[model samples]
Target: MPLMSDGDEKVDGFFRLGTSSGRFNMFDRFASLGVKWTGAVNGRPEDEFGLAVVTASTSPDYRRSSAAQRTESVAEITYRAPLSPWLTVQPNLQYVHNPGADPTIRDAWVVGLRFAIGSRLID
Candidate 1:
């Protein structure tokens, strides 16, 4: 549930936890927490901005064989804007620490884009 809102502008926060059942999985535990803000941009209510942090722990069973680091963490920032009623574009940036949970690999900065398309079934 959203914690606060004023018209189309709002702030929301969330947390998630997950676990894998099998021993063969690369990750045994996952957790994330984040907050997002949505509001009018150029008088359009569809624009949104978000920031988040995430972490994952390597499974003990998998780590024993690979000698991998215990955990990986990431910090992310993103924005979403509408290109049209049915299309939207999102640009994202992330800093990954301990990429793949391997200390030998350098931390990395990643940039990416996402596109979303949707339509109503009955107009």
Candidate 2:
């Protein structure tokens, strides 16, 4: 929720955890933690900085049947900046370790860009 707030500036954190029965799900356990800061960059309230890590465990049944590794994890860093009131762009960098939980596969670095657009129907 709201971790800290100073006038129009703020910081927030989040966590997520999940589990499955291991019957039909590919992953039996999953977790993620993240934090975001607003208005911390050059006094731009619309700009945001974020960091997060996520991990998942392959279900026992699925690992046994598919010969998959036990776990996969990723760490990511990102920044979101607004181009206008209704449009924003986010650039992110990620390091994926044990992707798909396959030992034969190599860990990799990934870069991505995302664009978000929003508008008010009526105001």
Candidate 3:
């Protein structure tokens, strides 16, 4: 996926004008595009399971802020496998990036896992 934006403007004192006729106004615009692929293998060397991959990107532009432009990207991977006849486990990992900011909450890597148990209750 791909995205693009282009515009021309002129500002005189407090008034602004666009290239055509409309007045230039301060606004924030954002655009995002992504792609994903998923498939399952009946029998393979790695594992007889499913696999998926997703990638996304975002671009944000602000005309009236100290931070004018910003970009971010993220990727996630998940794997599921049968532990036993009545148990299953899934693990996930993610990568993220944020440009222009302190290392507080936006720039980091995350990992997680999930487990499921299936059984019939006996009375």
The global C-alpha lDDT for each of the candidates, from Candidate 1 onward, is 0.88, 0.91, 0.41
Worst 10 residues of 2 by lDDT: 114-123
lDDT of 1 by residue, 1-123 (tens): 587899888888999999995397888999999988888465867788999999999998878888788999999999999888788899999999999998799999999999988694235
Model 3, C-alpha of 115: deviation from truth (Å): 1.0
> Model 1, poorest ten-residue lDDT window?
114-123
> How does model 3 fare in lDDT?
0.41
Tens digit of per-residue lDDT, candidate 2, span 33-110: 999999887668889999999999999999889878899999999999998777889999999999988888999999
- List RMSD in Å for every model shown: 2.1, 1.8, 16.1
User: With candidate 1 superimposed using the best TM-score fit, by how many Å does residue 100's alpha carbon deviate from the native?
Assistant: 0.9
lDDT digits (tens) for residues 1-123 of candidate 3: 212222221111111222221133222222333332222344322222222332222222222333422444445566666666566787877676653322344666878788878683232
Runs of candidate 2 with Cα error greater than 4 angstroms are 120-123
Q: Score residue 44 of candidate 1 by CA lDDT.
A: 69
Best by TM-score: 2
Error of 2 at 103 (Å): 1.3
- Candidate 2 global Cα RMSD: 1.8
